[model samples]
Target chain A: MTLLVVHSRLGKHRFEVAKGLSVREALDITALRVRAACGGTGACGACVIHLVGGEVSAPTVAEYMKLGSDERAAGARLACQVRLKGDTEIRLDRPAPPSPWKSIPLENLKPLTHGLPELRAHTLGVAIDLGTTQIRVSLLDRRSGRRIATRRGPNPQGVFGADILNRLEAARANPAHAAELAKLVRTAILRAVRDILARDIGEVKAMLAEIGQVFIVGNTAMLALLGGRGADTLLDPANWQGAIDCRPHDVTPWRAKGALPCAELVMPDPVAGFVGSDLVADLLATGLTEGPAGALLLDIGTNTEIALWDGATLHVTSVAGGPAFEGSGIRHGMAAEPGAIDSVCSVENHYRWRTIGGGAPQGFCGSGLVDAIALLLADGRLKPSGRFASPPGPDGYPLDPNHPNTAITGPDIDAFQRAKAATAAAMSQLLIQAGMTWRELRRLCVCGAFGRTLHLGHAQAIGLLPAVHPGLIELHAEAALAGCEQALLSPGGVQCFDALTAKTKTINLSLLPGYEDRYIEHLRLRPIALTPTTGQRP
Target chain B: MLDRFIKAYNEAVFETDKEAAFTAVNTALAEGIPPEDIVFKIVIPAVEEMMSNITKDPDANLAQHFMTAQIAAEVTEKMLEKFEHPPEIIGRVVIGTAHGDLHSLGKRIVMGCLKALMVEATDLGVNVPAEKFVDEAIARDAQVIAMSAMMVHTATGEDGACKVRQILKERGLEQRFKLIVGGAPYRYDTELYQAVGADSWAPDGVNAARAIINLIQQVKHRDSAQDI
Candidate 1:
């Protein structure tokens, strides 16, 4: 057996493996997080590790293709391709800093005056928004329905991959991997619960004994993975439009494992397909269902979900917007954190940008990318067809001349185009299916972290959003979390969610006839036309 | 004047200038240029040249490639209406994304290019089953079956290209239809096509059109030789 030592920001982790075991596998066994955007196929070159000591097998063809000569010379190698020949020591450098949590707007949530049968004077309840990229938890006092504490952090399951599809593929491929993913998420939630209680209230066990219910909401794939079942069914495209059974066979063991005495663990069923309870929660929090029709809610993320309420029926569909919106798969893209460029504009033939926290520019976020493209289009530097007026250099167009390393490349624009196209096309299709138009939309609720900092005009100019009047648009950053909190505290919350699901009709965009044409038409970097006709430029 | 028109048309298509391209075509029509000649000599050659040039430019954007294919397809359809005699289509092809894959951009681009090249391309849409690929090809009398998969697992998954290849082998229709695959996974690993039992692969949509054309020719030649 060969001993492998790995060092990351978390701490030192050591593992024992047979010869020829790749570094990625060793790290996986140790449960140390590493970025494998291509699921460790060595295609993405994201799993880079520096060799500080010891020897490994020779570099692979994929490494040669992805890594520069200088990088290889500096001892950087793809962990997925190189195997251990003997005892080795390596450093996992450049770990992404954890994104800070957006404060949940408790004021926006409806006050829970009535309690459920399980609620008691000293009892508490937990509400969790299990997002693919981030997880937020809120602890509530069951009697008064007041939030005691809230915690949010990056989802630890991201080590498997950034997108839900990657994690679903990984879970479906191996049973052990599926179990590990479930355990990792469950443990993270338990730790957050413990941390919150330990900080505010004394006696962790006593506080745990006073908990009544733990309410959770997430996408279909996430809920399925957490239960360690129903993931394989999602792999087939035929089941994409049907309701997936995300409820676990049992939660007694999970609760027992965490040593919680909650009376019940409530995970409301995900609506049909990838439309999770999160969107249902968003609708509930925003009151879109109760409003008089012509209201649209778009919760944009890696998997963007759209809900159009056209008076009688609520049409919902999920589009795989990819990771471009969340700042993955770009040349110099990062999450909406400090140092991330969150806004950009052209000033006097030069570009000016601002970071999230007024810090030095690191890379572009989704909003910043939209602003840059929109400004470029207005300046005639970039055409509506997505080509540069003058061909860019090898490094591509630099957003800031001072920070040449932070630039947008040709592939970045392509990624953004595909993402925005998918989103814009889905919006159009949903409207058409509902026999409505953009002008009919009286209320447009944009939900998610990306929409929070997004400039409405810039988003519309780049065709990411429709050319609707700015007055109709509203940005809700923590709608999902607020919905989860409302459900956790209200007496009729479960019934409300059930009612919303009953009315939703999921339109599978892939199966639609003219969806492809609409997608291609919206691929251009211009405002989506107000009309529903194809091949018409705005 | 015809030479100048061809140059202007090629440049317009290369720059994705739709209005300019249509104007150039209309001008050629006014000058007594045959519609068939406009398609065969101007549009087809321009598409071929743009694709060839794209191969040389490392920074070629997909939007440029997509527009080139779209413009070519639009021009060809317009000119085909004015052909003195019905121009003969080279062949037929059935294309789609493999089962469990929802990506349609690559497939759509390939279909556009094939149509511009005078191939009757039938789109099966996305998440197409393996049997569907074979059935559609046989139904349409297509000479080639093309599949696109953007992810690694889908490219090599049991329900994807491998299943199509398996069905073709079982039915002994291997010689009747040629298999071609393209997408990101195939571009990452050139040998992946063989592993998935594909006859050939292309890195992008423009090259994919050229590859499918060659495969169709090979299928036709095989049928003729067998007949002999």
Candidate 2:
């Protein structure tokens, strides 16, 4: 046994662990929260800790790659890679205030479904928007058919992998990790439910006796991880035959044993391919599927999902947008939160910015990055080829000179470019395949917490979104959650989703002709040329 | 005449002038300096020099090397155009990035090198299924099938090298075409390449063309021996 002390802004704690256990394992045992974003693959260096005392194993190759010589000399080691050789004292840094992207506001949410009398008396309905990085939960009062309380928290699986690809890779590497990821998500949901109900395990269990239903909306990868299904097909792109198991699972047992009560937990069936029920929910919430056709729905995240309704059938595809949109891999990038720069503009050769809560800038969020890139391109500071004109400072362009900490690194710009290119490519491929022009689409519906704060002009300027009629662009915040709420409230909407899925044709963009040319063409951060469609309806 | 042509080719490459390099090759062809000799001696050496310089100096200008490769590819293409005998199609080959691997830079270079050698090469784009490689090979009557598995996770699947072999074995066409696998992942482990059922392996595009050519010859010799 070895005594180890960990110091953090959350305060210091001491632990005794068996010799040779990695620092990450020790932290996990003690329940000390730390980010191991690559799940101890050592690929993501989020688990860096300062070794203040005692002996530790030599830094792993990943640590050497991630940390500078000065950092290594200063006793910096990746916690996930360092196995304790002797009693050690380590320091953990405190993270910034939790980002607003963590929670979705359910204000002004109208009831889309009517209640069931028998179920209303006995059960409470819960709608969950299970995101890759964060989980948002909304509790519904069965009697009034109104949303009562909403709770949000980091998905515990985040420690394993920050992005879906990493998670899928982690699952492929170890079956046990796959099972653990699913268990962690279910546990997090239970924890969120308890927090929302403000009740103990016993009380929550008792309340479960009257459970109406639960709806989980997330990407296919998230659903597979939650539903405990083999996700090998999602990881291997070639293995994808354009079919996904859309059958909803009854996951009540996942939380039932943990002291929460749930009679039935129904995850809506996933859309074909990697587009999950979330898009199905997006379609329902945006009313895109209900209409006389020609509307596109794009929910941008780590994996940007784009759907185009061509009147008769739905065309859907997911682009490998990477984790830039979630602010995961960038140096000083973070989710939308207090102290996070939400927007950027250049005036008189100086960059100006706005923070989420107007505090000192800690980092740039997704929206701020989009705005910054657009502004940088507008000037000659950044090129359409995704290169900085002047040699970048240590962390590239600082949004504000006073706040050196809030800056976009050269690598950050590259990541942002790749993400935008993916989104643009998917949109173009979807439109081209459907034989529809941007003018033909009656409305372009953007949904997601990230989409809510996105500057439409900057997005269009960067070619992240096509140049469409300004009046036709609609933003729906937390539409996935709203879709889940609709599913829970109305049985009819669930049937509608079934019909939509039947008509939905998932297109593998790689298989399409001119896909490569279109993708390469859109890689440049330039607007798509819009032809004159004077007679087109806006 | 040969020495003068070599000097001109070297000068054109050093200056990174594609037009000058192409003209130098044209002059060499007009002087009766064999196209294959120019390719093996001048073009390959220039590309090899650039690669070695890059290795020796980490910060070496990559644009020069890319320009040289581009010029070499163009010169070979142009030389092929002027050939009277159509440079007897050495062999037909199909190449692509294996399933789950989307990287294309290496594949593009390798395909260019193969095309430069006057081999009929069909390129299936990145993220190609293993079946597509076999299907294309069968359709084109290709003598070699080369696949790049850039990432460790994407190198071999039941549908990749293994699947390619399975399809060949089922059709009893195992001796018809040679299989060569290249990429960063399989470079260090030749044994792993064999385990994945590849006939041979190359580290990158720089050496892949030579490996594929040799593998095809070996397959041809083996078929002749079996027939005898």
TM-score of each: 0.83, 0.69
**Could you give the interface RMSD of each candidate, to one decimal?**
3.1, 8.6
**Residue B3 lDDT (model 2):** 78
Q: Which stretches of candidate 1 lie over 4 Å from their true place?
A: A1-118, A257-259, A535-538, B15-20, B30-32, B226-228
Task: Report the lDDT tens digits of candidate 2 across residue range A1-538.
Answer: 7877888887767665668878876654233545644446587677788999888898788998999999999988888788999989999884323332222332324454566454535557788889898787877766567665566678888887676766877777788987788888887887677554431122455565555567788888888788666577677665454556633364455545544454466766677547878888888888887775778998888878889998888899887776888787778888775567878877898888877644568888888889988998898787665656684755577767788866777678767766777787788778877887777878889886465778889989988878887788887777888888877777563686787778888887766645544554455667865652222211
- lDDT per residue for candidate 1 within A1-538, as digits (tens), equals 6777778888776655567778865554223535554435577777899988887999999999999999999999998888999989999985423323332333333455555556555468888889898888888886676776666767889999987878988898899999888988888887777755653453477788788778889898889999888878877777878778887787865668445765477888888767899999999889997886899999988899999999889999989887888888888888765567888877889899977544468898888888888888889888777877886867879977789756878778878888898899999999999999888999999987574778899899889988888989988877887788888778776787888999999998888878877777777888888876675421
TM of chain B vs. native, candidate 2: 0.81
Question: What residue runs in model 2 are displaced by over 4 Å at the alpha carbon?
Answer: A1-103, A106-119, A169-175, A199-205, A232-243, A246-252, A255-260, A393-395, A531-538, B1-92, B99-120, B125-144, B150-153, B162-228
* lDDT of predicted model 1: 0.82
Best by lDDT: 1
